[model samples]
Structures are given as C-alpha cells and as structure tokens.
Target: MKIDELHQVFLNYPRVCTDTRKIKPGDLFFALKGDNFNGNEYADQALEKGAAYAIIDEEKHTGKQKILVENVLKTLQNLGTFHRRSSKAKVIGLTGSNGKTTTKELINSVLSKKYRTIATSGNLNNHIGVPLTLLSIKEDTEIAIVEMGANHQKEIEFLCSIAEPDFGYITNFGKAHLEGFGGVEGVIKGKSELYDFLIANEKGVFMNADDPIQKEKLKDYINKYGFSTSDTKYYQIRLVEANPFVVISVEDTIMGSQLIGEYNFTNCCAAVIMGKYFNVHLDKIKAGLEEYVPSNNRSQIIEKNGLKIVLDAYNANPTSMYAAIQNFTKIEGGTKVLFLGDMFELGESAHEEHQKIADLAKELDFDNVFLIGQNFYEVKSGFKKMKSFDDLKNHLTKYSLPNSTFLIKGSRGMALERILELI
Candidate 1:
C-alpha cells in the first residue's frame, strides 16, 4: 500500500507501539527489527495484544490485520515524516553532543506553559525515535520540540529532512559517541548539522552568546540568545547559583529551579531565552522553569539515611563527567565520597580518556574516591577500583560510609544508581 494510505490508517488509530508487550487496544503496531531480534516474528503477537493493525515487512507475516510493507522501519519513518509535514505546529529541531535531552525538556517545559507541546520521549532522538516523536505530535500542538541526536555526520541532517523544523538549537558540542563519530573534530562537524539545517532553511536559531564556539558559528545568523545584554542577543539571562538547584536572574525577574549542577544552568538559560523569543511572558517562563524538576537519575539530589547522594547515572562522557565532578566537588556538606564509573563509546580513545578522567579525579581533593568498570581498571589513580557495582556493594557490606555525601555516576548501562540501595 501507498504511504498515504498507511498515514490514513495511522490517523484513525493515532497511536504507535513498537513492542507488542506494551501495545494497547486500537493502537497501530510497527514490527520494527533491531540488532538481535526480528519484529516481523511478533506481528501476530502485537495483533493478539489488541493492536488495531500490525505493520509488517516480511511477506510471510502479511495477512488480515497484518499490513505488509516493503520495510517496516522505513515505513514507520515515512509515516512519522508524513504526519510531521501535515501538522500546523511550529517545530523546533535541536541537537548537540551534550545536554540535548535536558535542553529539550527545559524548552518543552517553558513552551508548554504558553503553547501545547510534545518533546522526544526520554533519549528517543535517533532515526526511528525522531519519527516516533514526530508522529506523536497532535493536531492542536502549537509547538513541537524535536530533538535529534547523532554519533556520525549527516545523521542530524537526515532527521532534519524528516522533522523540517521552523527553528533550531545546538546545545554545546562535547566529547561523546567518539566510536561512531571519528574524533573531536568529527563531533563538531556532526553536531553542527543542526545549524546547517537552520541556516539552509533560513529558520530562526537560538544561539548561546556565552559559548564562544556558538557565537562564532552563529555570528552570521540574526536570531540568538544568551546570558548577556548584547545588541545581537534576543534574550539575556544570568546564572545566580547552581548548588542543589539552578537559580537565575532574567532581566527584571529571578527564577529558582529544582534542577541541579552548573551544566544544567545552560539548559535552563536556553529555555528562558527560547520562551521569550516565542512570546511567552517572563513570569510564565519563570514559573515553568521553577516547576520543572530533574528526574531519571539526571542531576538528582537525594538525602536519606543521613547521607546526601547525587545520582547522575542517566549517561556520561568525558565532557559531562568532568563537569559533574567539578560541580560535585563544590557542594558544601558532609564528607564527599565519589563513585566514578567508566565513560562508554570512546572507541580507541577509551584508555587515554579514562586515564585523563582518573588523572582529573586525583587532582581533585575529595575525601574518598572509588572507580568502577573495566575501562578504569588500567587507569593509574589513587582512587580504589571496583570491577563492577556488585564488587562495590561487596566492599560496602564489610564497611559503610554513613553521613557522607556521595556522587554516583556512570553510563546508563552501569546501573550505578543501585548503589543507592546500599547507602
């Protein structure tokens, strides 16, 4: 069947589910295949779970409720793109090496105050995820915050072709996904694709004036934002403090946020600036920023069992891990105990980068330091090394550090947050 026909069917159902286990009655199920599993095999299971239609690409699975397509993933992407083009909502496409998700959430929080909005769920900002997010955009949504993430060059450009955003923002470039993107230079070229999209399309840009790289890249662009009262800046915001939460002064107003760390300060500033650009009142913007709270183990502070815990285990790379360590050291309280987990996706640079992180940790004056993961095993540091979280827990079973402040962080796969159960 044609894409138009499939889109019509999607319009009728208006819900997309990839997992049969999560499928709801009347939802459209896409049999998407992944590295290890073939979703075509689960097409019937999706229908049995009450999905209105099971979109399949395998000819053998095609029949009755199972709608056959040439390619299941490609079909879903097309459906998402088709839905995006048909929407009247103004789209904001954003990408970066770091802070993309937080910035997306901040923008969504601020914009949702004045406009009906939907953002990319969690970290679903990839090839399949972007389309899923775009397809989720409702007819009444005034703004769509489509976040695009990439490890290699041109990936953002491809996502842009699908999202076709009216505006763009690139949260600062950082060292991440080095395995997929060739090197640091590759990281820059890859993330700058968002700027390329906006510049090529003549769409508005939300530039950060405080960032010299952003200033240079967006120097030719007119639309911009930052923390200074510059002639070229569209909005100005100043960071007051970022201890346990972000506190900012925006023009005549002061906003205190529930988010933590200095990295998040930029994220909040971007939101306030974008809110003002979209004509949202400063008061509403402040309220929205204040209402927003950090979750999913990204910059969350929990005090329990007389110990202060900083959980930032959602993800980690060289740049973000460095920033997290910098901020964790500054917080004044009980004895600081840091559990630094290995940064992933460094590829060939894993050893060197992990050594750098170990070196940085030694330079810092923390009370106790414990390093986990195989990447850190060979790194020379004064910090104690644990092969895994279980190893750390085994040590803790013999000895406990109560009433001490702890910074627990690692890549998502590390599950370092489980350390909370011990503390």
Candidate 2:
C-alpha cells in the first residue's frame, strides 16, 4: 500500500509501536528488522497484545489485521514524512557529534515555556528514531524539536529529508564515531550534511559563532543566527563560572544552570537564543534552564559515601573526554581523582587517542588517576591502569578515597557508572 493509504490507517491508530512487548491497544505496529532479530516474526504477538494493525514486510507473516508492504521500514519513514508535511508545527532539526541529546532537551525546555512543544524522546536521533519523533507531533504542537544523530555521511541528509525542519542546529562537530566517519575530516563533512540540507532548502540555522569551524563553514550562509561568548552581531552570553554548575550572563541577566562543564555553556546558550527568537520571556527562559537537571549519567554529580563524583559515563569520545577532564581540573577543592575509561570508536587511532589522554592526565598530575579498559591499559602511563571494570572493581573494593572529588568518564561500553557501587 502507498504511504497515503498507510497514513489514513495511522490517523485511526495514531500510536505506533515497533516492539511487540510494548504493544498497546490501537497501536500501529511496524515490524522493524535488525541483525539479531526479525520484528516480522512478532506480528502475531503484537496483534494478540492489542495492536490494531501490524505492518510486515515478510509475506509469510501475512494474516488478519496485517498489512504486507515491500519494505516496512521505508513505509514507516514515508508515513512520518507525510505526517510532518501535514503538521502545522514548526520543526527544529538538531544534530552534532557531542551533546546533541542534552542540547535538544534544553531547546525543548526553553521553547515549551511559550509553545506547545514535542521533542525527540531521549536519544532517539537516528533514522528510525527521527521518523518516530516526527510521528509524535500532534495538531496542538506549536514546535517540534527533532534531534538527528548521524555517524557517517548522508545519514543526517536522509533524516533532514524526513524531518523537513524549518530551522536547524548543529551542536558542534567533535571526535565521535571516528570509525564510522573515517576521521575528523569525515566527521566534519558528515555533520555538515545538515548545513547542506538547510542551505539547499533555504531554512534557518542556529550556530555557534565561537566555533571557528562553524563560523568558517557558514560564512557564506546568510540565513544563520548564532550565539557567542565574545562580542558578535548575534546573541552574546558570558560564562560566569563552571566550578561544578554552569552560570551564564545573558543581556546582563545572570542565569544559573545545573549543567556542569564549560563545554555545556554553548548548549545553554543555544536554548537561550532560541528562546529569545521565539519570544519566550527572559525570566521564563531562565526558569527553564535552571530547572533542567542532568540525568542518565551525562555530567551528573553524585554524592556517595564521602566523595563527590562527576558521573559522565553515558558515553565519551576524545573531544568530550578532554573537556570533562579540563573542567574537573579547574574545580578548586580537596584532592581531585579521575577514573578515566577507554574511549571507543577511534578505529586505528585508538592507541594514539588513549595515549594522548594518558599523557594529559600525567601532565595535570591529579592526586590519583585510575584508567580502565584495554585501550588505556596499553597506554604505558604511570597512572594506575586496569584491563577491565572487574580489575577496577577489585581495586576499588580494597581501597577508598575519602574527602576527594572524582570524575568518572568513559564510553558507554565501559559502563564506568558502575564504579559508583564500588565507591
């Protein structure tokens, strides 16, 4: 069936579910396939669990209340594009290497102060997630914040085609997904695909004037608005301090944020600029920024036992890891400790990247540094290096660092957050 026909069915059953376990009454279940599992096989289960209709690509799964299509994923994406085209909500497409999810959340919080807003839930910023986010927009939604995450070339371009955003933002390109993106240059070109889309379609772009790369790349794009720390033609926000939490001054109005790290200053600024552009009251914008608390292990400060721990174990690449370390170093307090885990996705540069971080830790000379994961173990640093989390756990169980501030960070695979239990 065509996408329009599928959209008609979607109007009746507006709720869409890709997992049989999450199926609810009146949900339009789309069978998505992955390397490890085939969602088509669960079509019968989905219907039994109260799904109104099951969309399947496999002909063998055809049955009552089942719609067989050439490709279920493509149909779902097309339906999302159709819904977005019909939506009255002005969509804001956001992407970047680092801090995409946090920035997206901040933008949503700020925009929702004055408009009925719907944002991409959590880290749902990939191909499947982008379409699902678009499908979540309702008639009452005044603004839709869609976060698009891409690792390689053209992924953002494809998501942009589906989202068809009226405005766009790229957080900042960093050393992330290096394996998939080939290298830093590939990362720049891949992420700049968002800019290419916005420019080609004549959509507005929100940028960081402080970033030389961003400024240089968009030098020719006239429809760009930006925020910067120093004086610029666009918005200017000053960073007050980032001892533990970030405080910024916007138009002489000092706004305090729960977010940590100077790196997050730009994320907060993006929200403030977007809020002002949308005419949200300055006080409301401040309230929105102040109310947001970091969770899901992304720059969260936890107090356990006697130590203050900065848990940034959600994920890490070289760029973010270095920023976190630099921020931790500037905090004046008792002894500073670091639990650095191996950065992932560096590909052939993994050894060199790990060595760079190890060398920095040595240069800073934090009171104590524990490096975990295979990459770090091979760095040949004087700092304590553990082959795995189990090794770190054993060491932590035998020792304790009291009255010290700790920064724990690594890629998601390292599960560095688990160190909290040991501490």
lDDT of 1 by residue, 1-423 (tens): 899999999889999999988999999989889899999999888888899999988998888888889998889988888898899988999898888888899899999998999999998999999999999999898899988989888999899988888998888889999998898889988888888888887888887777778788888776545555454444667778887678998886889998888888888888987898889998999988988877899888998889988989989999999999999877877888989898889999999999998888889878899999999878888688988888888988887786799998899889899988886
Report the lDDT tens digits of candidate 2 across residue range 1-423: 888898889988899999888888989999999999999999999999999999999988898999999998898899999999988999999999999999988998888889999999989889899999999988898999999998888899899988999999889989999999999999999998888898998989999998888899889989988998875787989999998799999989999999999999999999999998899999999999999988999999888888888999999999999999999988766889999998988999999999999989889889999999999999878888899999988898888688999999999999988988786
TM-score per model over all chains: 0.97, 0.98
Report the lDDT of model 1 for residue 405. Answer: 91
| Inter-residue clash pairs, candidate 1 | none
Tell me model 2's lDDT, rounded to 2 decimals.
Answer: 0.91
Q: List the residue pairs that clash in candidate 2.
A: none
Instruction: Please give me the total number of clashing residue pairs in predicted model 1.
Output: 0
Q: What is the lDDT of candidate 1?
A: 0.87
* Cα-based lDDT at residue 253, candidate 2: 97
How many clashing pairs per prediction, in order? 0, 0
